[model samples]
Target: MSLFTDRQLTALKRNGFVVLSDVVDDDTIEAARDAFWDGFPTDRDDYEGLTTEPERFENAWEYIEDPDPFREINDQLFPYAEALAGEGTLERPDGRIQVTPRFPTGEQTEGDERPPLHRATGHIDGYGPHFDEHYEVGYYTVMAAVYLDRVDPRGGGFTVWPGSHWYAGDYYADHHLESLVNDATLPAYEDGEWTRGEALAHQTDPLEIHGDAGTVVFWHQNLLHCGGINTSPYTRLSAIQRFVRPDAEEIKRDAYANPWKYWEGMDGVELPSAPSER
Candidate 1:
């Protein structure tokens, strides 16, 4: 049987997103969650806003970049992405699958403030030179957050504007495409800048999903989304993966720029901008 049901496929096509509720099952998700805590012990008093802590990635390897374990999961879930591509239709040259984990509250390090949900992360993903210019088609990157633990609204959940991908995509293809041709780029700004209300024009009803650990939230690369604030004390850790569907090459050529992407040179030298980033 296909991984995705007819209803699920239709939702993806019509709305450009879907939530595979409990698709991974409890036991499987628990295993991954246990492994996460075994790596990072959240016993301290202050554990909010510590995404950059060395210990976060110190114990466990970053799964988004980890393919050894990812291949197994992808084999089980890839059919859905393929189905969304269209029945019997092969994925484009750049099609691939990936995962992402959002850490809203982190261990209090030496220098940091209580992290506010960054808003601009919603716009440009995958390979955009500026914030909103570079665009890719055929699903270059899809954001999927596999909830490993129970995520409450205060647990640093994903905040998204539903049906915003089509609007954002069309807006860029309309207004920004010309700017790209003219060498126009994102205005110089500090990190974590929020393009407030820019995404609201595309979506009237923004969605913030907070559910059980087994719920998986998926969104398009161009979709306007963010990880909202964490009012709870528990750490919100998810196994985030980025996916591709064989259609990555074409997207790479037109939309994505390999500015900081990692690559390997001929003599074992690593180039950050090769075919893929490690």
Candidate 2:
């Protein structure tokens, strides 16, 4: 009953994120960008020889061991993530729903230097240090993506700070997510020192997110966002994917410091004031 629309659930509870257009169909995002350029070794007109290959950016099963084209794009994004983590949340038979691979990258846009938004960073999807110093309160509540190409304006989209996920869930509900793991220990919201100095010290306004090829977005696992810099000329190709909210865990004890306490679709909404309490 909740595949969103109370104005997209109040713009995902005050702009944490939302954008479910054409949910998969531009010929399945050009056959998922031809299964991400069939693991390019370069030659789609060699867009800078496949974005300066580091193994053409690795991940789609390190170049297709084929899980049936990522389970047909996770059966079109697992029913909007089981209608927003509700209906038996991914049918958990103990093994709560988890379908991986959202790979395929290529940021391409350093020749024109756009770096604004205080030099961009806005994190929070499985936290930094290359992830896993344990921090996923209730596992993975939501992150989705799926674009597969056609993002315009400044191209490298999916940026965001709009209401910076309730000021990063009110700064992890008063810091202590494993003692804010590194950045010289919470140097300004977990390492990489304050993405643009905490969005200009919390005035907030970074947005970006243009879409087309089967769009999808979703966001909000304490959204803050980043990965936007291709200052236009094209080279986006998104994929991301992550859902988790069934038998979740790994929230390393802070006695559950309310990051929207398990987001029951963000109950009534309002919440947004923690850049040191605004």
Candidate 3:
């Protein structure tokens, strides 16, 4: 049975992303939020002084490793992701939580600034010219981002370049690095170099995702995205998970493999025309 509607599948195929609103219940969101708060080290006076600073942290997996209260949220959201990606697409259940607590800092006040324009922070999830020692090669198929708080413009929403994934897949394949699963080191390129430039050249409009709590965004692995700036009085919290295609192992072994080959039933689907084409 398909969990996604025809509209959703079309959105995913054409735009390279689909948003499922309120996929999780309010209870689930609150539970996860509470668990995170309880475990957070709020002892510092600085933590409460949001007016004076903003707090951001990644790799929230550590906090959940203990009693594991947040596991409930992941368990509930995983099925929706599976249905979207197709059956047998996941190799593991682990994901990460990202905490972005934005408040008016001493240098800036609430509504003082709008999020900077989307630039070419464009890169794929697992590998690219952005590859470095700190980042690992990725085997991610479909990437899911779930928002736990209301996300408004300038409130640190997720930003993405729509349809950039198609450009990236073909670009990497052209660069002769398509065979490797993880990080395939290429010549040193400037930041926001290839796809970002291509996206700009094509005048692709970057989307600043805004939604209510429990909004889930599913994006293609090759899509270029980044976390937007948080200029709101409220903090932004979200969880991200990457699922592997069923043929993850097989594709990982093939050097000439195109990542999109594993996307079930999408072989002949017509994607929306790119900006350059139109």
lDDT of 3 by residue, 188-207 (tens): 22343543222331255678
Clashing pairs in 3: 126-138, 179-255
Q: Tens digit of lDDT per residue, candidate 1, span 96-197? A: 232334453443322144344442234334433432444432335555666767777546676665555545444454343333221221222124332432
TM-score comparison, 2 vs 3, better candidate? 3
Q: Choose 2 or 3, whichever is better by lDDT.
A: 3
lDDT of each: 0.47, 0.57, 0.60
lDDT of 3: 0.60
Estimated TM-score per prediction?
A: 0.59, 0.31, 0.76
Query: What's the TM for model 2?
Result: 0.31
Tens digit of lDDT per residue, candidate 2, span 1-278?
55677777667766767888877667766766776567645545555554454421324445543345556677777777666655555532221222222222354345345556545556555554344543433346766877777776556677777656655555556665554443211234444234433333234557878777778788767666766656554456667667665455544233134555565555675534433334
Model 2: lDDT equals 0.57
TM-score of candidate 1 to 2 decimals = 0.59
Candidate 2 residue 37 C-alpha distance from true site, Å: 2.7
Q: How far off is residue 242 in model 2, in Å?
A: 5.2
When sorted by lDDT, best at the front, the candidate numbers are 3, 2, 1
